[model samples]
Target: MRPEPGFLATYLEPAQAARAVAALRARGQRDVRVAAPAPFPELMAALRAPPSFVGWITFPGALLGLTGGLLLTILTSLTWAEVTGGKPVVSLPPFIVITFELTVLVGSLANLLALVIGARRGLRRGHFAQGGPFTRDRIGIFCAGVDPAVERLLRESGAEEVTRVP
Candidate 1:
């Protein structure tokens, strides 16, 4: 048999969305999702989700970039050593430029790749609360594992409208 339905979506202002998300989590609903016209840092904090998965990729990409930069500097300097001005074979100061550029380049590329993959995983798709004018001018909170009692609680909690979607 098919599993039971999940969240019952509701429209609210940004502030109300934050509260509803918090309340649902308090009531042990972990599968909550919210949609808003713009970024809602407050609601994200309420849900306890991380700021962005891109951040996780950034750190490792930076490390890899730096290592690659250092390796490039070392190999190039050693392979094409020039003793024109009695300078050191491995110039540390000049390598900073390559290191910095590589770090930024790799970090940006990794962030873009992560965002694309995330979108494929439904990060960019609309949630239940994404209907009507809400996608353009309002915020929404969708509480998963909902029942009739939960729906009533949401209605009583200042939801402008509640919708149940299959």
Candidate 2:
């Protein structure tokens, strides 16, 4: 059946979803997303999503943590200027433990912040729900714009069910 103007989601088998995505791309349709019960290696290749930059987000945080950790250790060591049994002040070897701990603490906090931000962004872009089957056995192919060509392509590409979402 032809989907309504607000049409947004189509449910298909994994194979069908992959085919539909590939065909949609070939026809130059943008704004297509696939939701599957599990990761489909073939579908991922078809979607061609960009590699996640979450790791890059951690890099800056780790660098800041490293610098901050060393500074914190050095400053604390300098403040406690008690000469201990002919040992030099600002002892590097002893403070190594504190520096490492602080580095890990700061880096972990930063990483957690980045993860929360990423999760919020993802949740904001919610998918068109295709009921419960989608969560178990179905693959959902969601695309914006109610183009007739797109509808026809999806129908022809073997979607088991096609319905619109508000």
Candidate 3:
């Protein structure tokens, strides 16, 4: 079945947002998210999203690219040797430049691809609730896949404003 495509957003002051996030988590709501113009460490702690895999994927992809670049350099030099000043055909120093470039290229590409895939898996852009000027000046805590009872609980918990966008 397709996942629901809406979010419940509430605008609150930083401190209030933190509390709201904690309250949502305490109430067993796992799909909570927060957005703010500036950093909010407490809110981050409350959301507790699982670690991202971009780093892990990038490392191996970069290593493979480096290895491939080095192999290409070595094989090319050996297959088509051009003796200049009798220098060694397999020059590791020059290969370093190619390897480094390839590593960065592959790592960045892999990271971007992973981010796209990850975002598609329930990480689409979120919508905001209308809370007048408060939303621009305050933080927002949003919950996806909200149930009817959760809506009641949010209203009772001093949400100030709650909006569901589908």
Candidate 4:
């Protein structure tokens, strides 16, 4: 995929910027992001972002952890199979502890894996919006695509200043 090396940030009041973002989304502008001085529920309502997929990753991780744990325990027991205390060759009871430990271990590792994947995606060029001075009580509405229509929309939405970045 070709990366968009340049983007535009339209500075505006916090509330107006959030509303502008929402309006832009409603108009089918997909490559939009907002930066603000602080978090606000109104902004979230405006953005209407879908729920995060972290839970989906976590579920698969748990499944992998459980399977890995069971496999490890079963393999270890099979290799050292012996009748002890008049028990079966593969003692299911003793294996439970190992299986549980491995399950938790693998599950934790999966969470770490998911975090790394998410970070990688975020770091990709044009995947993140560049907001300037967002922490200084100014809100920035960043758009990845630039065109005369987009610029006009920003001006009509009450932007105090509009600038481009690469």
Candidate 5:
């Protein structure tokens, strides 16, 4: 058995890649892949991918942290029945620091985990992340199909070089 060839179009600037992505999408080529040294908001918009949902993870993590902190302080206070310095038991002031700390900690941890999973998932998709020109200078649009229309579209969109991969 033989592996199917791939097609790649390299761009000097992100705008060129964005143009290629939009053209590809217009042509119903949803498997287009983009690789660049840094993030490009224009390219992302051209891809028309959904907005990130990492914030959803962080919000729930923060809520859980807040609840855990409140439970820890309140339950412990209730269990011990400690009263000191004429201050009421289960006071809210001292719990604020721990609650805030846990909220920040859990929220950030969840955000970090989400980002890592998202990156890995992106790699599993059509995205290319090879080191070299792709990492330091150029952006590439890759697809598994070797259709000439895709190649022509890429070239018309200002690709610097279009090549076929084995």
Candidate 6:
């Protein structure tokens, strides 16, 4: 199994995949990539992935939107100074709608932007198959650099199939 520098190990079960990853890390193999059909929290924990920063981006974006909405409505009202029937010109009730709308708009946009950026960055990390069962019912573990020991470890950890990357 320790045949080349790059190899793909396919696993049919999530627990086996997680164990493989944990074993790789324990053996000091840092360049490990995993592909799965769905999000596996236990696998992620085994990989020791950091918490996502999308919420950090979203919070600032939402704050900016809220401030912008408030300022836009308040400033336009002040600039025009259009006093209607009995309501005050710079009213708070009417501005609520616009403020809420902008907050949601910017927050969601920021969240989308963060995910796109993260995905693109992740794509550069390792070799991935263009088409594979990993996208359906299997999990793939891609090791950027491998040795015979790594390959044996993968099979021992329950890799059903192992192949050279290219």
Please give the clash total of every predicted structure, in order: 0, 0, 0, 0, 0, 2
In model 2, the Cα lDDT at residue 68 comes to 81
Candidate 1 lDDT over residue span 1-166, tens digit each: 3433555555556777787778878888777777677777787788898566877887888888888898999798999888657879898888989988998888888888888877576443345422456568766676655478668767777788777744
What are the lDDT figures for the candidates, one per model?
0.73, 0.73, 0.73, 0.71, 0.83, 0.86
Report the CA-based lDDT of candidate 3 relative to the real structure. 0.73
In angstroms, what RMSD does candidate 6 have relative to the true structure?
Answer: 3.3
- Could you give candidate 5's per-residue lDDT for residues 1-166 as a string of tens digits? 3545678889998987898898888888877778888889898889897789889888998888888888888889899998989898988999988888888888888889889888887766453545548877899888778788888888888988988875
Badly placed stretches (over 4 Å) of model 4 are 1-7, 10-16, 35-45, 49-57, 85-89, 127-139, 147-149, 152-160
Kindly list the per-residue Cα lDDT of model 2 for residues 1-166, writing each as its tens digit: 3432433445556677888889888888766777677888889889888876666767677777778878887887678878888988777887777767777777778788888888677545456443766668778787777777787788788777677664
lDDT of 3 by residue, 35-108 (tens): 67667777677678788777887888889889988998999999999976778999899899998999899888
Comparing 3 with 4 on lDDT, the higher-scoring candidate is 3
Candidate 5 colliding pairs: none
Error of 6 at 122 (Å): 2.2
The sequence of per-residue lDDT tens digits that candidate 4 reaches over residues 47-110 is 8878767667877887887788778877876898876789887777877787778777877787
As a TM-score, model 5 comes out at: 0.89
Q: What would the TM-scores of all predictions be?
A: 0.81, 0.77, 0.74, 0.67, 0.89, 0.89
Assess candidate 5 and give its lDDT.
Answer: 0.83
For model 5, the stretches where C-alpha displacement exceeds 4 angstroms are 1-5, 126-129
Error of 6 at 9 (Å): 0.5
lDDT of 6: 0.86
- Candidate 6, residues 53-144, lDDT tens digits: the string is 88988899899889989999999999999899889988889899999999999988988988888888776645565686877999989886
Among all windows of ten consecutive residues in candidate 4, which has the lowest summed lDDT? 123-132
Residue 23 lDDT (model 3): 83
Task: List the candidate 3 regions with Cα displacement exceeding 4 Å.
Answer: 1-7, 35-39, 122-140, 144-149, 156-158, 164-166
- Candidate 1: worst 10 consecutive residues by lDDT? 122-131
The residue pairs that clash in candidate 4, if any, are none
